[model samples]
Structure formats: C-alpha cells, structure tokens
Target chain A: MSLSRSSAIPRSALTTMAASRRTVLRGMALSGLAVGGANLLAACGGDDDSGPSSGSGATVKFGINEADGSGPAYDRLKGMADAYTKETDTKVSLNAVDHNTFQESINTYLQGTPDDVFTWFAGFRMAQFAENGLITDLSDVWPIDGLNDSFKQASTAPDGKQYFVPVSYYPWAVFYRKSVFEKNGWVAPETNDDFMALMDDMQGKGITPFAFGDKDGWPAMGTFDILNMRLNGFDFHMSLMAGDEAWDGDEVKLVFDTWRTLLPYHQADPLGRTWQEAATAMGKGECGMYLLGTFVVDALGENGEDLDFFTFPQLDSSIPADSLDAPIDGFCVAAAGQNQEAGKEMIKWLGSAQAADAGNNAADAPFIAANSGASTSTYSDLQKKSVEVVSAAANIAQFMDRDTNADFANTVMIPSIQEFLKNPDDIDGITASIQEQANSIF
Target chain B: MTDIEQTRAEAPQQQRAAAPPQGREKKLPTRDRWVVITMVTIPLVLVVLLVWVPAALSFALSFGKWNGFGDLDTIEWVGFQNYKDIATIYPPFWPAIQHNLIWLVFLFLFPTVLGMLLAVVLDREMRGSRFYQTAFYMPVVLSMALIGFIWQLFYSRDQGLINDVFGTQIDWYGDPDINLWAVLVATAWRHTGYIMLIYLAGLKGVDASLREAAAVDGAGEVKTFFNVIFPVMRPINLIVIVIVVIESLRAFDIVWVINKGRNGLEVIGALVAQNVIGEATRYGFGSALAVIMMLISSVFITIYLRNVFREERTR
Candidate 1:
C-alpha cells in the first residue's frame, strides 16, 4: 500500500551493491566479455538528493550525459567533483545519464530552473543556449585560464564572447588495417593516384576498401568530406562553410561524384550498422579500411588491438588533409547557475592540460590533448598520429552536419547520404531535396 | 460498576430520551463549517489546478503557433488555421490517419481471433494448462523498448534471427515495402499476450451448462462453440475490441523506436511525436495532431460506451 524509500536500510546492503558493481566492471573488461553482443557500461541519471543541504552544507547537482567511451574520465570527473565538494564543504552529486536520455534531462533542466551545473557541447549547438540566454558567457573565465586564442576562435560566439570551455577537441582521420596494407605491398598513399590505386588494388582483392557504418548516416559523410577537401581544397571548403552558394557548384559535384563512384565497394548490408560495428569488421581485417574520427578509438579496442591509421590520403597533397568528424565536447556554466564562482573554478580546472591527461588515460581516449604543446604519449600510436595529422593541417572544416542545422543535418542530410549510398542513382533527386531542405531552413 | 452502568445507560439515552433534546442539542462551534470548507476546498482546488488547467491549455494551444517554449504570451493566435492545416493539408496527415485506421483493424481482428482460439484451447484444463497461461502472457512483462530493439534485430537483413532462419536477406527496416508490417509484428507480439489473458477470463466466466446443453442437442464441437460459447463472450469481445482500437490509434513507442518516425512511414502518433519531441518544435502543430487523435479515438470509445448502455438495458 505504501510506495516510499523513506525507510532506512542497514549499511551492509550499500557495501554489497558497491562491491558487486566493481566485480561487474572487472568482469566486463576482460577479453571476450560478451559473445556476439558487445556490452558497454550503462549511463543513468536523476536522483533524489534535492533541497538545501541543511546542516550537511550546500550541495550542487551535476549531470554528465555518459557516452560509452573511456571509463576513466567519468571516474576522474566524479573524483574532481568529490574533491570540490570536500574542499568547499559542498556536497557534489554527479549524475551519469545515458546519451539517449540526454535530450529529456536537458530539456527538463532548461525548462525548470536547474539546481546543477550540466555539460554542453561547443559550436553551433551552443547557439540555441546563447539565443535563449540560457548559457553563461565565459569570456572572463576564458582569458583568466590562458587557453590559447587559436582554439577559442574556432568555437567562440560571433559576439566575441565565449559560451563554453573546450574540455576536449577530437582528432579525426581515416583508419586503415596495417596487416592489409602490409600484405598488399602498399605504402601509405601520398598522391591522388596512389590513393585510388591502393583502393582499386584492395577492391580487386575483394576487400571492401572503405568499410563504413552508415547506420548512423554520418559515417558515410567521412568519405564525402575528405573528397570535398581533395577536390575543392581547404579554402573552398571554408567558403562553402561560410554559407557561400558555391557549395553546390561544379567543384562540389566533383566531390559528390567521387562518392558516387565508390558505391560498388560498399555494397554489403551497409544500411543501419553503427560505426563501432563497422570498425569491428575492419579491425578483424575483414574489410580494408574505415574512415572515422579518432573518437572511434573507444570502439575499436575490443581485444586491445587498435587499428592503425593515416591522415586521410591526400588527392593533391596541396589540399588540406583532415578527418571528417572532428567536433568539440566542452562544458559551460548555465546563465543562471547558482554557483557561478564555483563553476568558473571548475572550468579553469577542466581547460588545463592536466585535465586532458586525466581524461585520456583510458585505453580508448580518442585523440591527443587539444592544447598544442601538451604531451599525449598515453594515446595509441595510431591515435597520436591522427592528432598530429589534424594539428599539422593549415586549415580545417567543421563536420558538415555540425556546421548546419542539427534537424536538417540528421534528418535530411544523413538519410540522403544513406539512400545515395544504397544506390548512387538517387544523387540528383537527393541532392535537390537536400538543397531544398537547406534553403527552407536557412 | 455504578459509573460503568451510568455510561452504558447514557449511550442509549439519545435513543431513549435525549431525542427530545435534538432540536436544541449542544451545537459545536460554527468554526467547524470553515473546516469542512477547508477540507473540500483543498481537493477541489487541486483537481481544477492539475487536471482542468492542463486540459484547457491543451485545447487552447491547439489553435496557436507556439513552438514549445517560453512565455505563454509569446504564443501566436492562429485561429482554426492549425486545425485546417492538420485535417487535410499537412503532408503527414491523411496517409498517417489511413495507416492508423489500418492499425485499428489489425489491432482488433487479429488479436480477437487469436486470443479466443488460445483462450478456448487453454480453458480446456489440459495438461500444464497453468504453465501455458504463464508462458503465453510472458511478453506482457517485457519493456516495449527492449521488445522494439529485439524485433529490429529479428527484422535485420544481416545476422538477424529471421533472415538466418529464412535464408533470405530482406531489408526489413530500409525496404519501405514491408517496414510497417515489420513494426506491426512487434506491436502484435506484445499485445497478443494480454488480449489472450482477457479471453482466458471470459472463457472462465462462460456457464458450463450451456456448452453441455449445446452438445446434448447434437451440435458438433464447432457448432457448439459458435452457438453456445460465442454468445457468452460478446461482453469480453466488446472490451477487447475497444481496448485494441484505443491502443492501435495511439501506437507510438514501437514505430518511434524502429525509425524515429522516418523512412517514409508516417502515422498520427509518430507525426505528433515528430512535431513535439523530434527535431521540430512545432508544439501547436503537435497539439493539433493530439486533438485529432483524441477525436478519432472517441469514435471507438462512443461505440463501446453505447454498447455498454445497450447491454445494461437488455440485462
């Protein structure tokens, strides 16, 4: 008749549950932890630790939408929050939520006056927060923290104010199988001919040259973005990114047509398989290569054999070479956060190189630190090389969907790419439809 | 003993003699009147605030241009335009409505037939009959989200259970030809178990003498089932039919999970979800869809309600 947890439990049960969680994590980390189905750590949130802390001191609620990446950073963040709580006599409650539920919690927090500091990504995504006056501008915090002006410019608001601190910047590049390259007697391609010939050679050998996870639709975009850079050069990409109509010009078609020609090789149940599963196929050397953001490092290390990678092989060598999926994930203080001063302190701690060090200690840290001079030896050799591939580039383009409206990007662009890949003959119609969707949105 | 006897006597004194003093009985303070008001006011105010206000707001917003945020004053008054747009003009309207109707048919017909058969079979008190009841309704306990993903796996072209069994690579999700049916299969799977249980109850409620009487009349087994058992199940049939109609019209979770309401299959629930929670924030449009869903559902509700009254009068 009663549905309440108001009854206190003996302390023994708490210890037992915590002990079992540790055992589960250990069981999960061992090789072949699961058959066919891969088991990732679950992320969940929402807890009943509300109201003022009373004599227990002030408490701050925090939410982290946990993506199953390296598990270490989450632990570090929890520890840091704990330390902050201990130092300031404030109770820190860190809520780890699943990515799928992120939108619900975010909308709730935004709608209701939130009693916690939460995470948000940088770039165009922050625009909604900024427009609604929901996010705190960290311009003052940015300068005090001594974060490089270079990184700030990439994600700073048009008003010359910063809304978020770049906790981590991802490095993106194409991953290829070392064993396949070695067996095929092919060195890493330096020229357009070399790249195509290597691909043709792999295709001739019945290896899918480009193993992609278009299940998400964004993965096929990696190949397209690389082609854009190859055909249009870095400056043209910048121009198109600046909302120039030249995006649909002949040079862009050349890029689109490049994707059209690659269809024959990708025809094996390519619709709706995730990027990680795509990498699983590539990692086992079943497929020749997979072009992905370095973030895929989190997915590829099933048995600790990280696939080797190269800068997406250049077409002109004069054109910039970068991966298709480098976006930033950072934290920001909400405009009306209760603990503004404490939040600034948190941002300063997050922006430092040590933060990156703690964040990347796990086996699956996607890329090296964003801070230019920070050391990243803890990362896999392929990942470190991928990071260098991005940093060394004179120019970079924002991933397409990110640089566009999220609605159009996910719904129209992604599905269009998938449909086009299923049959390239759908290009003209799909492109026209995409252009129309963009036109309507913009 | 004297005090106890006096109290016992006083207990019955009202019936015996104190009844004469009732007109002038000792009156509690009029303050108690306020207490009654306070007790009733609390519940009345709460109900009006919680239920009536939201219902009013939903109706009001069905005629607005609100985009799911901020001050209520910011909502634009758009007249019957929202309704006009949704009724026939909107892209996802009619096709989705047609699909929903098809779903209503599927929901009632398939389940009713299957449930009656299963219930009749199980009601025979055959060996392990209890086990069959438990096993039959097992899927009702599973989370629909889990069921959706499981069904998606079954429908998958590669490494899927169904495809593996059939030895044919069918694009269950992508191929628009059979995707809706694929989704319907999962929905039917979860709902059939419950519908079957309801029939099991109806079968139990049937009078034993009637079926025996029909058999004694020289009716064949099928004839006895049709002539005797079928009539007794009409009430349960009406209940199951109404519930299925409502569930099918508001079917959102399975379809939403399968495709997020995309891949060219549009239904009213999915469309409403898209406008409200999907990338689009057309709250007014979503409310318009909700109102329409309510209107469509009320048709089935009205039929069932009228049947209830009619059955009562007959009884």
Candidate 2:
C-alpha cells in the first residue's frame, strides 16, 4: 500500500507539473502580448490596416449585440446589413455576440478591438463612451433626412455632439389585452383617480391589477421612471437620474411611497417571477395589466394584435403624464475601429427611412423605427398606437437604467429597487440606502 | 514495517546515497543544468507573472478609484475610501458575507452528511446499488450553470413543475427570505452528488479487514463505521472539508445564472463580478471586494495547508 501510494504521488505530481508547464507556455504567449509594452504597441500598429480608409467597396465591420440565428432581432440586423451592402456595394462584415455578454463586456470591447460600427443604446452609457473617446464623434451624421429632432437629441452626447444614430425606439407603457379590457367595458385611465378606480375594479373581480415581476431587476425601473416623471415632473426625474439630486430627498421618497401603495395590486412575490411570466399572466387574462415595453409582445408570442397600451396616468395634477421612457436603440462608431469613414457612412445610411423599411420588412417582428419617414404600413395596431403616443409625448426620458450612471444604476438602483419591492413599507430606509450608494458612485 | 514499506521509506535516502557528494561534484552537465534551470525558472516566472502579479495589482488597485477607462494614469488614489464605503454604505457587502457563511454551513450540514450516508449505504453493494450510485452522481457531472437552469424548471414561480404539481403559489426563486434557502436546496442537489462520489471513492479505498475486525468483535455496522472506518478515513474527511470550503467561497455561477446574485443571493464572488465584469466599471471598489474575499479565502487556506503539512510531517 505504501509503495503504491508513493508511486501514485509522484505520478500525480509529474502530471500536474507537466500540465502546468503547458499552461505556463500558453500563458506566457498570451500575456506576452497583454503585458509586454512593446508587443502591445506592435499589436496596435498591426491593427491599422484591418479596414480600408475609403467608403466605396470597403468592408465595415458591424458588431451586433444579438447572436447570429437567434431570432427576429438578428434577422433585422442582418436584413439591414444586406440592404446596405446591396445599395452601397460595400461589404458589412458581422461580429455578433450574445446580448448580455455584449452589454457586460462593452467597456473592454470598446477599449479593445471593437468593430467599426456597433449596436448600442442612446443613453448615459453612450455619452460616457463618447466622453472617454472610446466612440467616434458622429456630429457629421446629424441632420439625417428621415430622423426627427427628438431622435437627434436622444443621439447627442453631453458635449452637444451627435455620437449615436438611433435606428429604433420603444416606449414603456401600461399594456393590457384589448379583448379583456373590451370584455370588461374598461377604458384606459387618464388621471390618478381613474387609475385607482381601474385597479379597484380589477381587484373586485378577483383579478390581479398588475402583472409585475422584477427578478431581472430592471423591469421595475420602468414603473419608477413613469412614477417619478409623473409625480416630480420630467426635469427633476432627469436631474435625479443624472445624480444631481439626493435620492433621500422628498422627490425620490415620494416615488417609493406611491409605489408602496400600489404594491398590493401587483402580482405577489414578484422577485421570483420573470417579466415573461408576468406578461404571460396578463396574456392569459389572469392579470388586468402589465406596465412594460412593447417587447412584452415578444414574450406572449403574439403579433400584438390583442395588445393595446396607454402611457401611465398622471399621478399629480400639476405634472403631465406626457413624459415617458422611450429608450432608443442605435449604433455608434468605435474610434478604435480602422474604417472610421466607412463606419460613419454606413451609420448615416442606417439612420435613413430606407434602412428602417428594409429591417422591418425582413423581420418577423418590427420595431417602431425612429425615422419618421419609415413606412408604418407593416406596423401592428399596438405599434402604430405606440408610435402615435411616443410622437405626441411632450418629453421622452430613457429608462432609469439608461438615464443614470451605469455604476449607480446597476450596483445601487437595481438592488435598492428590489429592496423596496421586498419591503414596501421601508421607503425612508430604501431611499436613504440608495442616496448613500449614489453619493459614493457619483 | 513490511519489506515493501521499508524499501519505499528508504527509497529517498537510497537515491541521495546513489548521487555524488554535495557541492561542485554534485552539479549536472552544463546542458543538463541549463535545461533544469530553464524548466524551474520558466514556471516560477510564469506563476509570479500570471497569479501573483494580478493578485498584487488587485491589492494596489483596491486603494484607488478607476472606471476601467483611459490609461493607468486615470486611476485616482483614494486610500482606503473604497473599503470604507463597502463596509459602511454598500448594501450587498454584509449580506454577501452572511450568505457565504450560510452557504458554507448549509453545504457542510446537509450535503456532506447526506453524501457520506449515501456513500456508506451504496458501499454495501446491495441490489441496484450501482443504479442508485449513477442516479446520485448524475448531477455532479453537470456544471453549476446547467444545474441552475435544470432547477429553474422546478423552482420557477408560475410555470415550474413544483407549483404545477403541488398547486402552491410559492415564489421559490424571488422572495428574499425564501430564495436563499431555495437556491441552497438546488446547490445541495448538485453538491450531494459531488460529495457522495468523493466519499464513495474514499469508502472503496477503506480496507475490508478493518470492518471485519469490528464485526468479529460484535460491533454493529454503525459502530464499525464510527469506531474504525471513520478514523481510518481522516485524510478523506479533511479533503472533503477543504472541498466544501472552497466550493462555498466560489459559489457564484448558480446564483449568477438565477438572478446575477441580486435580491438576497449576493455572494461575494457574484458581487465582485457584478462590479468588475459588467459595465458597472467600479474597478477599485471591485478590487476592494476582491481583496476582502482573498483575505477570507487565505485564512481558510492557511489553516488547511498547515493541517495538511502537519499531517504529512507526522506521517
């Protein structure tokens, strides 16, 4: 036994040493480029010729967030790329990554070997990247023919330069099954009292008033965005998102207090349920409404024929409910990318009505194209209503996660909001916690 | 000692005696010496570069604030500010520490014990023992992320098999009070299989004579295991304990797959990833959290290594 044990120990040690030797070699090779200053400079210099300088016949590497062959999202992107290539005779090389992976690694991706034009969102993060010089200044892409002033404003960074080209947008609203509402003779609420009555009426019929879930931790932010916009007005909400206001201040405290009152009406124990499950509940007529983006239609696998929505009702008489979260999805040019002019030219074309039409016509589901000239003939009733509601809005705010600093929104607000959901009565405690974390992050 | 054991013990001394005298006479040929130096130096340098360098950098960065943008010059020195904020103001920090402790305790209490019991029962080689072994060890073959997904089908609130079958409205993965225990249950499902396999291997290595000696002395099965087999398996027990500690400390994937460790599933590993891996870009704060985690792991590791070395020295 001792002989076998001694022999086994040496064999295992030898194997471990051999394996680690191989690992060491591999590590040295990789870290040679990573850590060696001269090698890194050489690598950067080698990247210079990766793309052509001119537009015509040049390949523009497009890094899309959706993985290839995923769904309509990928199809839409592909369709746009194909359309661009066909029109401009320039190849659009695609680098597709999964959505969450793309979002999480965005900092490293931008700083590292990013593609020419990449899928991005118009928000604090875009502005952040622009400020850091990680993204190219696309001020020349502005005054895009089909895009409206609102889109140009959304695409602008804090430096007052357009750094993004918005392709599409979707508004967060109170979504309900049109058939169910019609069956119950219910009308969309316009005032705070009307909204309360609707909830009470739904409760009287033994239906959950709201099909809410916050397991992913960002869905609930839509609720807060609308509430804050309604209660404290758009300016205060925007200022608060920008970290210019204290979270413990009454303005922010009131949002939580109001959310606490409405908690009982929402689906109970929402932390376990996902937004998809909540949307399913509303689709099944088990719940009266779900406050979510138009993507809720995707969860239900419906063309949104049975779905309709209204902007959340005005909570205070003084503040108009016209302000809503209509987060815009767009593309940005990477300053590190080799083909700067080609990327800019492609992005400018992407902002046109033709690209939007091409994208919508190819996809199973269509987005509300940001360009006003995009044909709405393919839009469902729900989408048309969304377009109308968004266009008519006096003010548009990005969702809470997008409007605020990424660190504050992700590391602070997500947990703080979840805490509020878990214990609705502790408004002061939650707000104070948020304020403390926000102070540190900002 | 037997002849084989004696020879095995004397083998090192025999090798030393076979070699030349110490000093200049003991040196290898120049080429062979160069090969030896290269082999030793390369691995040492790699280890220092790959592991120690990053660890040291994490410690240094913990004292500064950087958003992972721009160059190294952009890092602002803030001297213990990140640590102060984590301790005083970070909502997830304390809960993450508490959760890690709960995870360790729960893994030890539930899975480790249950796995040993399963191992003992299966070691009897009863009818269909192999089938039971296969069934129990299946989850161990799967990754933690896959285990999380598999359990999600059972634990999901509205559409899960548990709720559908039991007709209960339990939010198994959402309620902060209940979700931690619910996740622990899922972890145990996988952990039990792991511990059972390890214990089974250990049990298989136990000599049959030890059990026979206990049986001939009129001791019962439980008594035989407790009095004889358990002590004989001390090495395995220590290994199991260390494995449990390491597993609990690195418990991130399952919770991350579930909800990115939010809403009461805030393990330290997930917290570090949340701040550092994602767009949060709180590099210094994340490094501080990482440093705290490293300190904690080092304490356990030190105790474990000391115990292991002490055992080796005594042997």
Top DockQ model? 2
Pull out the clashing pairs in model 1.
A215-A272
Model 1 chain B worst lDDT run, 10 consecutive residues: B1-10
Alpha-carbon lDDT, every model = 0.62, 0.85
Per-candidate TM-score against the hidden true structure: 0.77, 0.91
Q: After superposition, how far is residue B39 of candidate 2 from its true place, in Å?
A: 4.8
Question: Over the stretch A1-442, how does candidate 1's per-residue lDDT look in tens digits?
Answer: 0000100010111111112232223223211222111222122123343644322365666667664442655654564466555556666667676554455334334444343467666655566666666677778777534456656875577677887777666656767767667887967777678778888888788788877766555667667766777777765764564456543467766777877776666636566466776777787677887777765656765423445776776665565454344676667776655556666666655677665555555334333466654456766676566566666666555677555545545545665666676557756666665565455334
Taking chain A by itself, what TM-score does each prediction score?
A: 0.77, 0.90
For model 2, residues A215-276, the per-residue Cα lDDT tens digits are: 99999999999889999999999889999998999888888888888999999998888999
Instruction: Identify the CAPRI category of the predicted complex in candidate 1.
Output: incorrect
Superposition error at B186 for model 1 (Å): 3.0
